[model samples]
Target: MDNLTHSLVGALLGQAGLKRKTGLAMPTLIIAANIPDIDAIAVLLGGDEHLALRRGITHGPIAMVLLPLLLWGIMLWYDRWQTKRGARPEKRLPVDAKWLLMLAYIGCLSHPLFDWFNSYGIRLLEPFSSQWFYGDTIFIIDIWLWCALIAGVWLSLRGERRGQPSWRVPAITSMAAIILYIFANGLITGRAEQLTGRAVQSQFGIVPAMVVANPVPVQFWKREMLWRDSNHYGQGVFSAPDQVVLDPKIGQHEMSNTFALAELSKDKNAKAFLFWSRMPVLREELREESKVRILSDQRFGNPLVQDRFRVVVPTEQDAK
Candidate 1:
């Protein structure tokens, strides 16, 4: 999920009654919600280093515990500072250490839960185990979710301003609706994967080793399916009973030589990409007498969008 969604979720959680528990509760939730993303600093290192680190340690089990504690302490210090300066708002509830810590934990945990819904995947057990997990239920940027969250927050604010009773109801309802929406998408993804897997086997006469059904933005019932077999890879758009195979190609041809590609995987960038990629494919090109191999993850690799994480390696002869 994008940072906006994360922030909105945090704000909604605060509106859903958590704000009454302590001073600066809303800021604690909003900030903690986006805290794990501090790992994004890896992007400054350039290359695919960010890809290798994005959802790793900062989102792992160890950091999950420590990060919230840090946020809790910071929020408490800020509250004390405001009090010392005589700038604390009269309407602001007194800060409670226990409630602040609890909100911090809730906000921090929400980050990974939302991230798990997208195809980008997350390393929940990183450091301990760098395994990636995917929910395949929502697109990275979901307009519907944005609307739901925004509307809920807007309505809640309006109610509060109007001095209406039960101002928190809208936020609570929105959170429940979002959960149901996610559940529905999960069911759709599972069914679409099953249909795509069966259709691929029927059309290609080969069982797919893995199949992923990624949600299409704005099209709730539609999914983009990618499947792989030992020798070939296939992609298609699936809508319930119908499956359209857009591209089916021999997977072996993706690489010029299996041995060369395997050897190239030893590179640090290549190793990181392989570890992170869920549906990897390769393309080889010849420049002069050298072999240029480009490895990509098929999940996000399309003709129009060449934004897939790629690791280019030239053979030793070409390096010369």
Candidate 2:
């Protein structure tokens, strides 16, 4: 999920009445919600390092425990510092250490849950297992979710300002709606994968080793399904009861040369990319009499975005 969505979730939690628990509760929630993303600094290392480290240890169990504690300490110190300087607001509620810690944990936990809803995947058990987990239920940046959350927070805040009896109703309703939407999308993804898998087996006579239903923008009912068998990769369009239309550009380009792939893995970028790529496809290009091995993940391997997620290796001979 994007940072704005994460921030909105924290705001929604606050508006849903968690704000009354302690001083600076809203800020604590918002900050804690984005704490796990501290691993985003991995981008500075360049190449595919971000993919290797982005959602790893910072989103795992160990960081889950330590991060909230760290945020709790910082919030406690902030409150004390403000009071010591005599700059604390008089109407501010007393800071409750227990409540602050609880809010921190709640906000931090929400980060990984929302992240898992997208097809990009996350390492829930990072340092301990290094396994990737995917939900494939929603797009990375969902406009619908943003609109609902924003409306809820705005309405709730307005009602509160007007001293309405049920000021939190809007936020609560929005949260409920978001939950239902995610559940419905999950059902859609599962059904799409099932239908596409069956169609792939029946039409192509190949049992896919993995099938993913990737959510697209705007049209939530539709999915761009990508499937891969041991030898080939293919895609299809899936909608509702019986719409599974396979694309005609399916190819047996997974990896014909295991030796070449192994040799290329010696490079740092290729290794990191392979470590992160769920469905990698390799193809060769001829340029200036040199064989350029282009490796990319099937999800974002299209021509337009290939450069963004690709690693090129120079090979003396063409890979067979």
Candidate 3:
């Protein structure tokens, strides 16, 4: 999920009454919600290094424990610093160390949960386990979620400004609605994957090794299905009301030679990209005497968006 969504979720949680638990609760929640993304700095390393480090250690169980504690200590120190300078807000509620720590945990835990809702995937256990997990239920950036969170926070804030007794109602209701929406989308993804799997088996006489039902923007009922078998992989559309249409342009792997793959895998960039790619495909091109092999993850590797999510390895001889 995007940082805005994470921030909005934090605001919604605060508006839903978590803000009352401690001084600076809202900021703590908002910052904690986006803390794990500190790993985003890995992009500075260039190439596929970002993929190798992203959503890994910083989002793992170890960070989950340490990050909140760090945030709690910082917030406590900040509060005391403000008091010493006589700049603390007079209207602010007294800070409760316990509640502040609890809110930090709540906010930080929400980060990985929301991140796992997309097909991009996340490594929950990280150092303990490098395995990637995907929800494939929501798009990375979802307008619908944004609208709900924004509306909820707005309404709740309005109620509070007007001194209404039920100021938190809107935020709580919005949270419930978002939860239901996520659950429904999960069901949709499950059904789409199951139907696509059966259809692929029937049409191609091969059971797919993996089937991903990726949700698209705006049209939440529709999914872009990417299915892979031992020998081939293809894309298709799965629309609601029982419609499944598979594209005819099936893709095959051209890098079948063991020695060639070993050589290409020797490239750190290639290794990292392959480690992160869920649906990998390869294309070989000749440049003078050397062969340039470009490996791509089918999910984001269409011609329109080719440069990203890809790795290029140059070889002197052609792949056998």
Candidate 4:
């Protein structure tokens, strides 16, 4: 999930009445919600480092426990700093240490939970294992989620400002609705994957090793289905009740043989990419009288977005 969505969820959590539990609750929640993304600094290292580190340890079991403690300490220090500046203590709600710790954990946990809703995947048990987990239930950036959370927060804040009797109702309702929406999408994605898997086996006589139903923008019932078998990668679209649309132009690609892929994987970039990629496809080409290997993950590849997590390795003959 994007940072804005994460921030909105934090604010909604506050507006839904967590704000009453401690001082600076909103800031604590919002900041903690996005703190796991501190690993995004890996982008500065360039190449596939970002892909390798993005949702790994920072979202895993160890960090999930330690990050909240770190945030709790920061929040405590912030309150002390404000107090030292001569601000009247009575002007702010008391910051309870226990509540601060709880909010920090809540906010931190929200990051990975929302991230797992999309197809990009997350390493929940990282440092222990690097296995990737995908929900395939929502787009990375869903406008519907933005609208739902923003409206809830906005309405709740307005009602609170107006001193209404039940100001938190909107935020609470919105949270429940968002959960249900995610659940519904999960069911849809599962059904679409099942249908697409059966269809691909029937039509192509190949059993896919993995099949994913990636959610498309603005079309909740429609999904772009991608699958991988031993020798090929395939993509199609699924509309409810068995409508499968496979475009010939971008329909499928022959997966490179194991030996060729093994050779390519020896490259440093290829190794990092393969470790991070959940649905990788390798292509070998004879270009400029030498072997050129290109590897990309099918999850983010499309005709428009051709610049995926790609690593191109040229043979010594081409380098000469």
Tell me the spans in candidate 4 whose CA falls farther than 4 Å from its real position.
88-90, 248-256, 286-290
Reference-based lDDT, each prediction: 0.85, 0.91, 0.91, 0.87
Model 1: per-residue lDDT, tens digit, 1-320?
89999999999998888988988899999998999999999989777757888899999999899999999998888888988999888898989899999999999999999999999999999889989999999998999999889988888988988998889999989999999999988888998888888878887787988889978778877888888876578788877545456556545525345786677676777777777788877777886767887878878765665565778877656766
Model 3 misplaced stretches (Cα beyond 4 Å): 254-256, 302-304, 316-320
Tens digits of lDDT, candidate 2, 48-98: 767888888999999999999999999999989999999999989999999
lDDT of 4 by residue, 208-283 (tens): 8888998888888889989877667788999965688764433344454667666766667777888888877777
- Position 228, candidate 3: lDDT: 91
TM-score of predicted structure 4: 0.94
Error of 1 at 130 (Å): 0.8
Off by over 4 Å in 1: 241-258, 288-290
Error of 2 at 233 (Å): 0.8
| Global CA lDDT computed for model 4 | 0.87
Candidate 3 lDDT, tens digit per residue, 211-314?
Answer: 99988888899999999976688889999867899987877855455675787777888889878888888777778877798888867855666788788888
